[model samples]
Target: MNQWLLYGVLALLPLAALSGFLMGRKHRKGKQDNRLSSDYIKGLNYLLNEQPDKAVDTFIDLLKVDTDTVETHLALGNLFRKRGEVDRSIRLHQNLIARPQLSSRDRNSALFQLGLDYNAVGMYDRSEKLFKELLSDPVHKNESLVQLLNIHQLTRDWDDATKIAEELQSSLGVEQSKPIAHFYCELAAQKRQDGDIKAALSNVKKALTINPDSVRASLLQGDIHLQQKSYKQAIKSYQRILQQDIAFLPEALPNIAEAYSNIKDNSGYRSFLNKSLDAGAGVSVLVELSKIIQAEKDDRAAAELIGNFLKERPSLKGLQRLITLHIEHAQDSAKPSLQLLDDIVEKLISKKPRYACHNCGFETKAIYWQCPSCKEWSSVKPIKGIEGE
Candidate 1:
C-alpha cells in the first residue's frame, strides 16, 4: 500500500540526517573518516536488508549529541511525532534530553517536543509538568501556555482554563476572550445542572460581561431565568440573542415561545416571531410562526404562509409541512395519495442533518456549541438549504 511506502521512507529520515551530519564534519575531522565510512556502510546494508529499525539504531549510535547535531535530532523527532510514531519520537527526544552537554536552548526545545509527544498520547500529567517547566523560557512561554490551556479544557477544569486564558490575553495580547466566555458558560452550565441557580446566574453574568455578543451566553442566561420562574427576564435574555446574531434566532425560538407561554403572552410571542421572520430568520422560525397561525385561524392560512415563503426560497421542510396541512382537509379518495406524498417528504427531511460546523463541515442532527470534529467554539449552526433550516 501507499501508506506502507510512506512509513518506509519516514523510517529512513534519521539515516539521511545522520549522513548529512557526518559529511559536514568530514572535512575538519579527516582522521575519523575511516570509522564514519564503515559505519555508513553498515547502516546502508541494514537499510538494504529492510531492517529500518536496525539502520536507525546504527545511525543514532554514530551521531553524538552536540551543539552542531542537536537540531538534526530535534527535527527527526518532530518528523516521527507527526507520523504518529509517538514512542519513537519520545525515545529520540529523551535520548537528546539525557545528554548533559546540551545547551539550555536545545534542552528546552527537546523538552517541548517530548511534552507534545506525551500530550499526543493523553499523558496529560507528564505533558503538563514538562510544559510548566518551560513557562519561564521566553521562546516557549506563549506556546506552553496555550498547551496548558488545552490540557485544562480536556480535563474540564474551567477555573484553570479561565486563568490561563486571562494570562494569554494580558501578557501576550492573544485574543482569548471568546474561549474565555465559553469557559464561563461551561461553568454556568455545570452549576445549573447541579441545581445552584444563584451560582449559575452569577457565572452567566460573568460570561456576558466578558463577551456581550455571545449568543451561547444569552441562551444559557435565558434558560437559567426560565428555571427560576423569572419569565419576563428570560424573555429579555432570549430577545438579546436576536440583536447579537440573527443567524442563531432559531436556537432561541422554541424557548422564547415557552417563556411567553408561561407569562400568558401569546400575542407577544406571535409578534416576536413575525419580527424574526422579517429579519431573515430561517425555516425553523417560519415553521414555528406557522404553528401559531394554524392555531389562531385555519390550516389554510398556515399553508398559505409556507407557500409564499417557498415561492421565493424552496425548502423540503416547508413542502412537507404544506403537504401535511393539505392532507388534513382532503377528500377521502385524495387523502391516501396526499399522505403518501407527505410521508416521502418527511423521510427526506428526516434523513438530512439539521446542523453543520462552519469550521470543519461536520454535520449532525443534534446541536453542539463546540464542534466535535474541529473542537471550535460556536462554529456549528443550523444547516441552511433545501433540506435544512
Candidate 2:
C-alpha cells in the first residue's frame, strides 16, 4: 500500500467510527445522513474498481479534515512515492504538514516523507534538511542517521560520513568499520593529492585503527614510507600484507623488493622469495625467484629451475620464461630451434588473462582492487596456473 494510502486509511478509521455512530443515531430518530453515506460508498466503489485517481478524488471530497484521516493521507502519499509518482507524493505530504489538526509525531512523519520525496527528485539540500530534523528526534534517530550517512556518502562528504558511521555503530550496533576505513582512506587520498602528507598519514592511521586488516591502508602506509625513504618501515608495512592476505602478495612484491634493495638486503629478499615459492604461493613469486636466480646464477641454472618447477606444476608463463632463457643461452647452431620454442610459448601466454576477479570471473590485463564488473572490494587478483602469473 502507498504510505499516503495507509495514512489515509488510518485517518479514515476515526471518521468511519463517527459516521457509523451518526448513522446509528439517525436510525434511532428515523432519519439518515444519506449524502455522507453515499459519498463514502462511491469512494469505496471507485477503489474497488481499481480507479485510484477517481477514488482519491472522491475520498478527498468526502473525508472531513480530522486526526483520523491524516494517517490515510500520509499512506496515500507514501504509496505515490513508492510508485515513482513523486509529485503526487510531495503534494499529499505537503498538504498533511499544512493541517493544524496533525500532532507533533504526525507532523514529523509528514516532513520525513516530504524529505524522501525531495530526495527521490534529486532535491538533496531540501532532503538533507528534513532528514536532519528527523535525526534530532529520538524516535526516528536510527533511520534519520542512516539517511544522513547515505546523503553524505553521495555528496563525498567523508568527514560527515565518518562521524555518522561512528554514531550508527554506537547507537544501532551496526558494523561500519570497513566502510569507515574506506572513507578515511578516501580522505587520506584527498589529503595526499593536496600535498598534506601529515594529514594523509593521520587519516591512514585512523583507517588502520578502525579496520586493522585493511589492505589498502597498509599499501598506502607502505607507499608513504617508501616516498619518505624509510625503506625498513616500508618493508615492514608491505610484508604485513603477506600475513594479512597472501592473495595480494603480487601487489606487495615489487615494492617489497624495492625496499629490500634500498636497505641493501638482497639475501633477505631472496630468502623471502624462496619461502613464498616453496609454499606454492603463485606464479608471480616463481617468476620473481627465477629473475633473482638468473641474476645470481647462470641462464642454465634459472632455466633448469623453471623447467623443473613446470614439470611439477605446469604453467604457460613458466614455459615462456624457460624458452626465453634457452634462447638467450643457445649456441648459433641451436638459435633457430630455441626461437621457435620461444614464439610458441609467447603465443600461449598471450592468449590468457593476466588478472581475474575472484568474485565475478571478470578478466583483464590490469589489476583493480575493486572489481569493476561486480563492484566488490579486493576480489581481482593475478590469474594463476598454466597460462598466467
Candidate 3:
C-alpha cells in the first residue's frame, strides 16, 4: 500500500516486459517465446484484476534469474527492500538463490540481499548466519564483516564485534580504533556491572590503549577506582578526561569533587574546579565551584561568582543555581517568589534533554555511548545550550 511500493511495481512492469522480450530474442525458439508470452499475459491479467502482489509474483517468476535476467531480479528485490517490502524482497532473493543456473557471484549477491532483508525485519540470527557464510567471499568480505559487526552490536556480543573489527582493520586497512575502543568500553561496563573490577579495569585499559582520547574509557576507569575507594587513583582517572576531551569535563566534575571529598581535600577540590572553569567546563563546573565558595566564604560571594558568570554565558542551570543562592539570602517575603522562580527553572531543565547524537539529532535525558536512533558509536554527547551543560 506504500506509494513507493506502488511506484516500484509500476517501474518493474516495463523491466519485466523488456526482460521477457530480450530472453525471447536470445532463445529464438517458438515454444520458448510462447511460454514467455503466456506468462507475461498472465502477469498482466493479475495486474488488471488489481492484485499487485500477485502481479509482481507472476512477473518475477516469468523473468527467471539467469545471465540475461539476474540483474533485473536483483534490482527488483533491492527496490522492494528499500520500499519496506522485506517479505517480498526475501522471497525474490530466495527464489533467485534457488535457481541452479545462477552464477557464484550472483548467488552471493542474492545471499547478501537476503541477509539484509532478514536484518531489516529484526531477524538478526538468520542474517548473522548468512553474513558469516560470506566472510571469505571476495566481493562481499568487507561488507559482510561490517554487517557482522552490526549484528554483534545489536546482540551486545562485544567480543565478536572486537574480533570482526580487528579483522576489518588488519585485512582491509580500515580505521576502526574509535569503535574498537567503544567495544572494549562496552565489555568493561558489562564486567563492572558483574562486579568484576579487575576485568573492568583491564578492559578500560585496553580501551585507553586503543584510543587515549576516549572520554568514556576514562570515566569508566575513574568509576572503578572510585568504587574501590582508591580516591587518589580515581582523581587521576577523572582528571584524564580534561586532557582527553574537555567537552566532557562537566561529567567528571561531580565525581572528581566526590573523590577529593573522600580524601578530605577541599582546597585541592576548589583548585581543580577553578582550573576546570578556566578550561571552559560547563555550568556544572560553575555550580560546583560556587558550592565550594559558599562553604568557604559566604552566600553573597558565591552569588557574585554565578552572577558574573551569567553575564558572560547565560544558562538555565546557572540561573537556577543563582536563584537558589538568592532564596537563601532573601527576606522572608521575597523567599516565596524566588522559590517559585527556582521551581520553574528546575522543571524546565528537567524536561530538556541532557545528551544528543552528533551523527543524528536524536536527543535523550541519559547518555548513550552509542546512539539509540542512529546506532553510531560515541555519537551521543552531552547537549550544549541554555538548558544543558
Q: Any idea what lDDT model 3 has?
A: 0.88
Return the TM-score for candidate 1, rounded to 2 decimals: 0.90
Model 1, C-alpha of 145: deviation from truth (Å):
2.0
**Ranking of predictions according to lDDT:** 3, 1, 2
Tell me the number of clashing residue pairs for each predicted model. 0, 23, 0
CA lDDT of every candidate: 0.87, 0.80, 0.88
Q: Of the pair 2 and 3, which is ahead by TM-score? A: 3
Quality of model 1 by C-alpha lDDT: 0.87
Q: Clashes in model 1: which pairs?
A: none
TM-score of 3: 0.91
TM-score for all models, in order of appearance: 0.90, 0.71, 0.91
Of models 1 and 2, which has the larger TM-score? 1
All models, RMSD in angstroms: 2.8, 6.8, 2.6
- lDDT per residue (tens digit) for residues 1-389 in model 2: 67776665555455445545555666688876678678778766665555556666666555454666677677767877987889978877887788887788988888988988998998888998998888878888888888888788778899998999899999999888877898899899899889898999999999989989888888888988898899998888887776666656888888889999989999999998887776557777887888989899988888888888888888877777887888766799999998888888787777777889888999988877557788555677777667765
Runs in model 3 lying further than 4 Å from the true structure = 1-12, 23-31
Once superposed on the true structure, which residue ranges of model 1 sit more than 4 Å away at CA? 1-45
Error of 3 at 311 (Å): 2.1
Evaluated with TM-score, which candidate comes out highest?
A: 3
* lDDT string, candidate 3, 1-389, tens digits: 57766775576678567756876775785456667777788877776665778888877777756787888888888888998998999999999899898899999999999999999999999999999999879899989999999999889999999999999999799889999999999999999999888999999999999999999999999989998999999999999887887778887777887899899999999898888889888889999989889988999999999999989889999999999988977999999999999999999999999988989899999888888898888888887777777
